[model samples]
Target: MTAVPVFLYHAVSDNPPRWLAPFTVSPRTFVEHLNMIADSGLRVVPLRQLVTTLLGGPPLPPRSAVLTFDDGYADFASTVAPLLAGRGLPATLYVTTGALHASGTPSGRGPFPSAATLSWGQLRELDAAGFEIGGHTKTHPQLDTLPRTSVREEVGGCKREIEDALGHPVDSFAYPHGYSSRTVRTLVWETGWTSAAAVRGPSALSSNRDDPLRFARLMVRADTDRKRFELWAQGEGAPVAPFAEGLRTRGWRAYRRARAVTGHPYRALPTDEG
Candidate 1:
């Protein structure tokens, strides 16, 4: 079986600066991108299908892919969801449960305006609409910064909340801030999640790796463009698995900025950003 390009998106809009750090893809480009995917012969596979295939589901179509979205942006319903429905494509939305209750400002480094995330009621509708609801975290915390107990809370709590609100079990999990450690992976499994995702590029299923918890993703952020997305979805691009790990040395900007604000060193920060 070929590796599926699990494309991750934040928002979809043509608004100025995109309102998020990576910003949202305008409806035009988004539709064009979907067209590109269709033209390329790739079938949009659901996330659970990918995992089931991993656990012995049958082989997928040659151009099969797993469409996923992180952060549970309200724009998903407002912007992307309608387009996807129009195209008869399936997608999964990994959400931060705590953010579902938030009615205020969005935190983190957003180059675009932070939009409100999906509410639990909205998520229920998404479930009814045939979208898989997965866990990102309880509060979108940088999982590495938190204690193991907190990690469980962030990982496990989100799943529980989604299940409770939607009346369906959320077996999949995406890391908050795309941050995870070996410990975080264990915590996710300990929390009873069937799978977890990271920002690693390409797909693990292409080669059929056994790891269900630490799946890599082509995290489509602000810099990613259409052609690049095509190349990535085809299993060709900078391997983002190592890039995500190297973000530790490379991500000291915010981590260090936070430490500098308090005059301290990065004691707990690790190089293993799984």
Candidate 2:
């Protein structure tokens, strides 16, 4: 069997009443979740270390796992950081350079659902503190929509920025908005990143031709109950769905739903555009 699942998370919150909007696993809940992973005998591996180990001589633990957070939320530093440290677990934090500070707007993904995104300085602290830091992008732009030049710049520039800040190479990436494509993956590899993550779930190994930057992820969300989270982490819950073709359709449907609820009208992208 494959070593272990790669789990992705947003906010490990202390008090997120609903999993829908806030997307936080309350700090108390987060602790429980962490304890669960720890007790399950899984090695909480960082992405780089996991990759390096698998490529080296020895095999990994039967329950090895990679914990990665996208968007560089502030809670990562203020909340999740200490907890992982206490458990002696290593984590990889993927960040969007745009949201690292006061430079860009927050995601509709939620209202400050992750109100605590990290800054460049905070990122450096995390890097210096031994947390592995990686890139998302400068503006969190959808990688597939941009032209080739923009894709290269967005992918490369953010890695460049993080490396410049932390004095270490940013060798991995997570697609912004969980969005990517063949073109985007090519650009990511061209940028020389070792690996990259996607929002899809049910983790497995990539074959030789698989894009190094296009790995999938499972989630232990704030809303997940212990049983479901366990099943998910164990790869027995829901099978990871291939969702690349659903983007524009789902997004447009969601937009329409929001508009209808608010009694507002909107124009969706032309049917041919997606």
Candidate 3:
């Protein structure tokens, strides 16, 4: 099986919020990872190329990988974009509509902790610079735990919001905290999303056979060191996707759903990281 590693990143900064530090990678480390990808001889492709291959459109070039970022962090505009643009690499950026900074607000109405998020104008500039802009919900809630109506509002409403702002249709969507159930995925598809990114625990890679609506992604975190990243770039350290959802994952979801019922769901600050 051909493994395509779709790398997911959050904040790329030396100084991130305390809450976001776990997922943040310094600019220096990020550059090292990019160099490692080049050294490993893996081509960085746009996410839609992988999606097209998964949907049976065409076979991906050999040893292709993807770059994707979540939550629209301000560092993406200031730091990440220049680096990627310098390398002429393509990437997809999924933004939480409600978390985007606007009108002097540090952050919007999302569940994320306080951080410098991207502004709408900056988002447009990023979009214009050729980075694919995708939706990450309006308020960054766990879709699987919400009611169907709320889920629809979050999923569908986000697409509409981004389209209204960007003046063009966006096809990619990423599940907040990488949590999605059958119902949530169905709702995402019904809302017209062509692809949705999901983190498959730690050290998992998306393959050609992976589901387009719930494709696996390998997360690059603060602790993702050189050895591990090289292993992922070589497609050697992770399990490829199209595996069954384990019993433990189901149990965890059940627990989170139970907590949601009590109106006190487990807040996965940025992600579940499990």
Which predicted model would earn the best TM-score?
3
Candidate maximizing lDDT:
3
Cα displacement (angstroms), candidate 2, residue 166, comes to 1.0
| Candidate 1 lDDT, 1-118, residue by residue in tens | 3566777776676663333644466678778778888888888878787778666767655667778887777778878888899989998888876667433444332311245666
- TM-scores of the candidates are 0.80, 0.76, 0.97
Instruction: List the candidate 3 regions with Cα displacement exceeding 4 Å.
Output: 103-109
Worst 10 residues of 1 by lDDT: 265-274
For candidate 3, the 10 contiguous residues with the lowest summed lDDT are 102-111
Candidate 3's TM-score reads 0.97
* TM-score for candidate 1, residues paired by index: 0.80
Global lDDT of each candidate: 0.67, 0.66, 0.90
Residues 1-274, model 2: lDDT tens digits = 3535677777776643343334567788877778777777666776775566434535556666778887777789889899888888888898877667643544323222435567677788888888889888876665665668988988999888888888877787888656666778888888988788775422332222223456556655545689987765565565433324455555754565466457673432101021
